[model samples]
Target: MKNTTLYKKFFVAINGSNSEQRPLSIALSGGVDSVVLLHLCYTLREQMPGWVIEAIYIDHGLSVDSDSWRAFCQRLCESLSIDFKTASVEVKAKARHSLEAQARDARYAALDSLAMANSMIVLGQHGDDQLETFLLRLKRGSGLDGLASMRAQRILDSGRVCIRPLLNASREDIEAFARMFAIEHIEDHSNKDDRFDRNFLRNQVIPLFKSRFNGFLQSVLRSIELLQQQQSLIEELTLQDLQTCCSEQGQLDLQRLGALSQLRQANVVRSWLASFNEKMPSKVQLEQLLHQALTSKQDAQINIVMGKGCVKKHRGFLYFVIAQDPPQPCVDVALAPITLNDGRALIVEHGVGVRAPNNNERISVQFGLLSSKIRPRNKPGRNAVKHWLKEAGVPSWQRAHVPLIFYDEQLVQIVGYYFEHSMYVPQQGVRWEVVDGE
Candidate 1:
C-alpha cells in the first residue's frame, strides 16, 4: 500500500483537521493488527497538515506478559516518534456477564479515559472481525441489528466518535502492510488458546469454510453489509416508534406497544437503546423486561439493573438510571458515620453521628409528632405507610421503592413519597432531615 494514500484514507476517516480541530488518539494493543494501525496513523500527519495523533495502550494485567507487551508498545511508539501512554485496568467480575465482557468493558473504560477530555479514539477492527461477528450473531439467532456487525465510523456511547480505518481491509492486507514496513509486533499466545469463542470460530470454523469456499470472508462481509443496511431502516423506525410509545414517566405505552407483534415490541425496546453497535441487552434480560412491561399493571413502576447501567419503567415510559454502587463503597456509598461514641446525639440520617441526650422539650418537626420531644419518632407509622399508600391508592409493592430514612435500626422517615406525621423530628434538639435520593 502507498503510505500517502493509506494516510489520506485514515486521516479522512478521522474527519481530518478541517472537520475536527481536535486530535485523534489511537488505541494500540501491540498486536500485529494494532501495530499496523499505528504505522498507518503515523503517516497521517504527512498526508494532512495539522492532524494531531496520540497512541494509547491499556495493560489489562491479565497475563504475566502484559507488562512486557506494554513496554514493547511504548518502545515502538518512541521509535516511531509518536507520543505513547500506558494505562492500567483491573477487570474484576463486577457484573452478571462473561469475564471476557468485563475485561473488554474495563479495557475500553481505561482507553476512554486515556482518550482525554476531547478527541476521538481509533480502533483497528478489520473485515475479518466484521465477518466473524456476523456469523457469531447469526449462530445465536440474533436479529438484523446483531447480524449487521461493527461499523466503520460510529459515535460510541461515551459521546466520542470511534473510527475504524481498516474495517474494509482484510487481516491479510494488514499483515502484508506490516511486513512491508518491517513493523515488529507481539503475538499473544492466548489467541492460540481456542477457549475463547471468537478464537474457536477463527481457527476451526472459518478455516474449514475458507478451504471449501474460496471467498467466504468476502461473502460474509458483503452479507453483513446488506444486513447493516436493513438494520439501519429498522433502527430508524424503532427510534421514532419509541418516542411516540414511551411516556414522560419513563414507562412504555402498553396500549400502543401491544398493537405490535411480539417480535416488533422486542425490536422497538432493543433498538431504542441500541443502534448499529450499541451493546444489546442479554436475551434473558430482554425477555424479562418485555414480559414484565407488557404484562404488568397500568400504574406499575419497574426498575431493573443490569451491567453498569439500569432500566426503569415509571408511569408509561422507560428511563435510564446511571447510579451504581459507588467506586469506593466503604467511603462514598456508606455515607452514615456508623454511630457516635458516648451520649452524643447522633444525627439520624448522616449514616452515623453522635450528640449528648438533651433534657430540652418542644420540638418542631414535619413528620407528624406529639408534644413528646423526640427528635425522631422511632419507626412510627411505618406499617401505616402501606395503609396511607392504600388510602392514597399507591400499590402494596411500591411502598418499598419509596425512600424511607432510618435512625440506626429504626425507620425514621419515608421521604418525598410519604411521611407519617406520627414520626416527627423533635424541636429544641439536634436537627435531622429526611433522606432522599443520593
Candidate 2:
C-alpha cells in the first residue's frame, strides 16, 4: 500500500531522465492493474509538468459488459481530468491461432492505430502476466525468443515503443495499491474461466507451483532474464548473418543460408521473415523449409505457404511473396495506360525514338504465359517462358504473376523481364513499359 515510491522509481527508470518531456499513453482495460497504473501515472503528472498523460480503452466487444467497462474507464479518466479515447475491434479466430491470441492481436492493433509515432505506450502486464505468458509459450514449444517472455520495453510494428512499467510488480502489489487508494475498477469474469490456457495457468498451475515452491515465480523470472540475454546475443548474430545472406531485393541467398549450421539457418530465416513483418514459421515448418532449401536440386522449384503469403525458392534465393487472389485472364492493353489486377499498370508510349508496334499489331497483357520460342533482346536462342524466367532467376512461384505482353498472340515481351527485339524498329517511334501503380 505504501509502495508508491517504488512505482515512481520504476516509472522514472523506464521512462529515462526525460520522462517528463514526452507524452505517455496508458492502456486502460478497466482492470485493477491498469486502474492502478493510471492512478500512479496521474499522480506522477503533478510532479512532472511536461508529461502529457492520457488513457485509452479498447473494447473487443466479445463480452456483454464491454460497453459498461468502456463507460467505467471514461468516468475514471474524467475524474482525473485526463484525456481518453476508445476503440472497438473485432476478434476473429484463425485456423493457426486461438481466440485469445486473436483478441490480443486486435487489441494491440487498435492501440497501434491510436498511438502517435515515437510515443511511448504503457501496458498493464505485471509479473503474473509475464509468468502466465512464459508458461503458455513453454507449453506451446516456443523457442528462446518465446521463452524469454514479455519484455519490459519493446518497439511495436507501428513504430510506437511499448513499455510495461509494472513488469517487475506482482499482481498482489497492484491489488494492494488499488485497495489502499479505494480505486474503482471493472472485473472481467472471463479471467477465471479455465477454458483459456492462460486462465488455467493462472488459476490452477501457478497456484500449485506457488504452494509447492516458496520462490518459484522469482526463479522463473530469473530464468526468463537469462533466456532474454541469450536471445539478444542470437539476434546480434542473426543481424550479421543477414548482411551476408540477404540479397538487394531482400531475398535470402539460399546458397549462403545453406552454408550455415541448421540452427543458424533457422535464425537467419526467422530474422528475414521478421524484417517483412511476417509471422515466424512453426518449428516443424521452419525445418522443412530449410531442408528443401539446402537439398533441392538447382532446377527444383520450391513453394511453401506461410501466413497470408508464401516462401518461394528459385535458382539460389528465397523470397516471400504475399498471396493474392487470382486475376481475371488477359486484360486487353490499349494505347493508353491500363491497370492490372495486381496494381501494376501497362502504358503505351509513342514517339519516344524507339520502334513502335506496327499499326496492325495488337497488344494484350496476360498472366501464366507458358509458350516457348520467345527470344529476349540480345539473347541467341528462343526459350520457353518458364526457362527464360528460370534463366533470369525469377522464382517459379512468381512467374504466374508476371505480366506477359503479347502482340496478336505472339509473346513479344515479359513486362518486367525481357523484350522481343523483332517488335521494335531501331531509332524510331513508340514503346511500352510496365510500372507499379501507387
Candidate 3:
C-alpha cells in the first residue's frame, strides 16, 4: 500500500472490519486523523477487494468556513479516487441535547441515512483520542464500563457498524503521515479556541500533567486498557445471566438481579437496557428501578416512566417496553378453534395474547372473551369480567396491558382467568383460541 497507517495493526483490524457484508464509509472532517484514514482506505482499496469507500463530510453549518471545508473534502476525495458525500445538518444545543451530544448524534444520523444495509462507518479515533475519552469518563467518576469507552465493533442505530481503525494509532503518527503525503487537511480554528474540553486536555491540562510526571499519557492509557478488560468480562457474565433469567417476553428478573453484587447490577442493567436500545435509564433511575423492582411487594404494581418508555412489573414479570400503547394485535377470536400454524391459537386483548392449549390442564394463567351477548359467570359473576377483575384488585395502571378479550361490544373472556360459561367450548374436544384483537 502506498499510504499505510502509522501502525499496521489498526489497518489490519479495520481491514478485517469484522463484517465485510457491511461496506466502509468514512467520516471525513478534513482533519489529520480522518484524512489519513481516508487516504489509507483509498490506497488499500485493491487489497480490501470488495470494499466501497464513501467519504462523508458533515458540515454543522456552525461557522462561515464550513462550506469551504465541504469543498475541500470533495476535492480531496476526488484526488484520492473516493466517492464524496456531504450532509448539511443542524446542531441543536437545546437543554435536551448538549452541544457535543447533538453534534455527534446529527453526524451519525447523517451517516446512517447515507449508508447501505449492514455497512460499516469508519471513524478517525486513534489511541490518543481514546485516552482522552477514557479520561473524560474517569473525571465523571464512572466505573470501568465508562472507562472502556469506544469499542472496535459497535452497531449503530442505522444497523451499521461503527469501526475505529486508527484506535491504536497516535496523533503524532497521523500528523507525520499527513505531512509526509502533503495531504491538504483543513485546520479548524476552533481547535485552537480551547473552549472544548478535549482541546483543553490536548493543549493545557495534558501538558501540565506531562511536565509533572513523565509518561503520564501512557500510564493513564494503560489503566484504561485494564478497565476495558474488566468491563468486557462483566458484560460477558451479565449477558449469560440475562439469558438464564429472561422472561418469555424479554422481562428481567429483579430478584435474580438484586442477588448479584451492587457493582454487577449497574453493569447488568446497563447491558440489559442497551440490548433493547431504548433511551437508557440514568444512574439514579437505574438505582430506583432496582430498589422498587426487587424490594416492592410481589404483587405491587411498579411502573417507571423514563426515557422513551416505561418499565413495569406484572404477575412477577418485569417489562421494559415502549411508552406508547401498541395497537391491539388485529385479531378476532373463534370458539372451538384449537390451533394455528401447528401452534396453539392466542386470544388477543388490549395489548397482550393468551395461549391456552386445548387439551392442557387449567393453567395458572386466566383467559376471557368479549361479547355483548355472552356473560360468563365468575366465582361470583355480577357485572362484566372487566368490572369484576377491576373490583377484585387489578390495579388500574396494570389493566391496560392485561389481555381483555371482547366479543363485539361486550366483554366475554379474559385470558388466563376463566372463560365465560355461556361462551365456553360446548364439547370435550372444543377449544377457544386468542387472535389479534382490533
Instruction: Give me the candidate number with maximum lDDT.
Output: 2
Question: Which is the winner by lDDT between candidate 2 and candidate 3?
Answer: 2
lDDT of 3 at 406: 50
Which lDDT tens digits does candidate 2 get at residues 338-418?
777778776776653235556787767777866645877788888889999878877666778777777787877776677
Number of clashing pairs per prediction, in order: 22, 2, 27
- The alpha-carbon lDDT assigned to residue 309 of candidate 2 equals 82
Q: Model 3: runs farther than 4 Å from truth?
A: 1-7, 19-22, 46-50, 211-214, 326-380, 387-398, 401-410, 414-419, 425-438
For each candidate in the order shown, give its overall lDDT on alpha carbons: 0.66, 0.80, 0.69
User: Which candidate has the highest TM-score of all?
Assistant: 2
How many clashing pairs in candidate 2? 2
Q: What are the TM-scores, per candidate, against the unseen true structure?
A: 0.70, 0.85, 0.80
Ranking by lDDT: 2, 3, 1
Q: Where does candidate 2 have its weakest 10-residue lDDT segment?
A: 349-358
- Estimate the TM-score for candidate 3: 0.80
Pairs of colliding residues, candidate 2? 354-428, 355-425
